[model samples]
Target: MTAPLTDDEVGKTVVDAEGKELGIVAKVNGSRAYVDPNPSLTEQFMASLGWEGDDEEDYIVTEDMLESVGEEIVLRGEI
Candidate 1:
């Protein structure tokens, strides 16, 4: 079986099934990982790719959706 990821590896890039740039793992809250759609995008940009909140907001992604953790994080589906 695959090993589980640790907190240190949580804030990695979350890619899509096709290896597309989806978002970056912001933080792990409980059983969910908050994903920041575009890590480089500033809050004032107001782009649709980002999470539905300000820079201080956290987007909750379930642990089950997490695919892998390495140089980049991978998710099961689009964020």
Candidate 2:
């Protein structure tokens, strides 16, 4: 089974299976990672250890959609 995502994922870049840049991980709650498509420096900094953000534009990526996690986080399919 695949391992769950952690708060360490915050700030990491997220991409689709085709390598299309989707966004950056802003927060991680349990197995879900919140992606901020256009985050400011302050928003990025405030995403410490899974603290939730108030941005309505942010989207959620669940563990089932995760493909891999390395230099960047890659999703199994398009967003």
Candidate 3:
């Protein structure tokens, strides 16, 4: 069954099992979370150099990663 989306789940901090910052919950669409993944070194460098191209690279975190759905989305691990 699909888990219910908590009120605070969206727009909250998502952390790994060991409390590493993965990313933020950009939007919760249906049962999916459109997570904008942490930028790569190249992307960061390009941004630093004033590149404004859109980077449509993001990951979808599903119910499988939710160890808990409160305060923060505590993931099972690095997923």
Candidate 4:
């Protein structure tokens, strides 16, 4: 398993294996990252897309799905 994402991951660009920009990390909680597919939203709205919400619109990326992390977060496979 991959290591958990840190708080710094928030706002980092997220991409797929092919390097397609999927979204931005809206929030980080332990091993999970709440991704905002629509990056144009305000920071306040982005932060609301959390695990505690019942909304299915929010996307989640786990540590195991990560391919690499640097200036951006790349997933092992396309979401």
- Relative to the true structure, how large is the alpha-carbon lDDT of every model? 0.58, 0.82, 0.62, 0.74
Report residue 77 deviation for candidate 4 (angstroms): 2.8
Off by over 4 Å in 3: 1-3, 6-8, 38-55
Q: Give the per-residue lDDT digits (tens) of candidate 3, residues 1-79.
A: 3366543354566788998888666556566665546755664454345342333676778876677777677778645
Model 3 TM-score on a 0 to 1 scale: 0.62
Model 1 residue-pair collision total:
0
- For model 2 the TM-score comes to 0.81
lDDT of 4 at 69: 82
**Candidate 2 residue lDDT tens string, 1-79:** 2578987888888999999898889888898888999988887677644455747899999998988988789898643
**Which is the better candidate, 1 or 2, if ranked by lDDT?**
2
Query: What TM-score, over all chains together, does every model reach?
Result: 0.58, 0.81, 0.62, 0.75
Best by the lDDT measure: 2
Better of 1 and 4 by lDDT: 4
Q: Mind giving the per-residue lDDT tens digits that candidate 4 earns over 21-65?
A: 887787787898888777555653544443222134559889989
Candidate 4 stretches with Cα past 4 Å from truth are 44-56
Worst 10 residues of 3 by lDDT: 46-55
Could you tell me the C-alpha RMSD of candidate 4 in Å? 4.2
**Tens-digit lDDT track for model 1 on 4-61?**
5445544467677689976766655456666677565553233233333325644666
Candidate 4 — worst ten consecutive residues by lDDT sum?
47-56
Better of 2 and 3 by lDDT: 2
Global Cα lDDT for candidate 2: 0.82
Q: Candidate 2: which stretches are off by over 4 Å?
A: 45-54
